[model samples]
Target: MNTQNAEMDVESLQKRRRGCFLDAFLVGSVMFLFAAVTTLAVVGVMTVKDVESRLKPPSWTSESGPLKLTDVSSSAVFTNFAYLEATTSGLKNATMQWAVQQTSVGHNFQYDRTNHWMMPVQSGNYFMYVNLNFTCTHICPSGDFTIHVGEGVVDKLSCKVHLPKLQDSTAVIKKCWTVSSVASKQKLISHMTVPKEGLDNWSLDMGLGMFLVD
Candidate 1:
């Protein structure tokens, strides 16, 4: 019986030794995996930083430390433009004359008061616009009036309005266009044609504007 007990004790000791070795192997594998993941994470972060540094603009820094980006001038914000309003002086020939108001023009666009035309100095794409305001003083007949903006006898942008035969009627018309590759010194004028009845009853209202847009 004593020999049997000694054999059982030896078997138990062997089992404990095997369990201890398995636990030590599992701990080592976990430690190795954690170390590999940490190294890869650090390497990926360093690579991203290196790529960012390469992508930065050369203007971002100078010999005198980092440069302020606000000091650079941007041409996109400035635009040359002009605005003109219809004057009440020239109404006998049914042709409209435009003039720059003291508060209307912007960036010093070229204008010829004698010819009453807008002339662009720089040849490029330009936007043209016009607004025609008309109001009836007394009873009026049903008719349509056309407003034109262009060189002499050539219409570029135009708008038309139909007025019903009614007393104290009002009509507002607006037109705009983007002219591609406009030449320098090209003249543009705004004019209208109204019948005798329209001239007697319906007159052009204030705020009628013809302008050169950027």
Candidate 2:
């Protein structure tokens, strides 16, 4: 009878140990699964943010760049100047980038790099001038380079510069137009085109200057 009792006690001890081990294993597995799910959620959120940023248009500052608001007490708001330099090798048109901001900017005007244009936040009469210089290694045969203060609109101002048939020469052109009147949200930007014949081995410099007259 004593032997039988001892055997029974040993069996119970073994069963209890197995149960404790099984419980520990189950708990560890659950923790691993929870950690994996949390990690995947974080990764998914990061990927969504990246995709949204890529879908957005390329902008230098904001919906618009550089605020246009100046105090009327001073004349600084009426004075402004912007310039850029670009070189083209192919026959394609090269759009000027306002990389350099020189001179005073008024509260009524704003500059946007994404569109490469200087726009007026408030409408008023403004005296606008555009200057273009093109230097080419070879002479142009057909068309002359055209420079404009405002291009592709009804009130656009333009100047055509004749390229002399001489290699290693520079053609200089300048034009001034009184934006006699501009409605609110109107833009006055500078644009120029280089002839396909003289695009090779050439450098072009463009500048736009404006002052509020009214």
Tell me the TM-score of model 2: 0.51
* Model 1: lowest-lDDT 10 consecutive positions: 69-78
Write candidate 1's Cα lDDT for 1-214 as tens digits.
Answer: 9999999999999999999999999999999999999999999999989854432212334487653322221222222545456777322345676544432443324667787776666766665555455666676566777777677777766767676676765554444343544567777666776665544566664333323344
Kindly provide the TM-score of model 1 when superposed on the true structure, using C-alpha atoms: 0.52
Error of 1 at 13 (Å): 59
Q: TM-score for every candidate vs. truth?
A: 0.52, 0.51
Model 1 regions lying over 4 Å from their true place = 1-79, 89-93, 169-181, 196-198, 206-214
Model 2 ranges with Cα > 4 A deviation: 1-92, 138-142, 170-176, 195-198
Please provide, for model 2 over 150-191, each residue's C-alpha lDDT reduced to its tens digit, 9 standing for 90 to 100: 635554566666655656565544444445565566665655
Angstrom error at residue 53, model 1: 43
Q: Point to the candidate with the largest lDDT.
A: 1
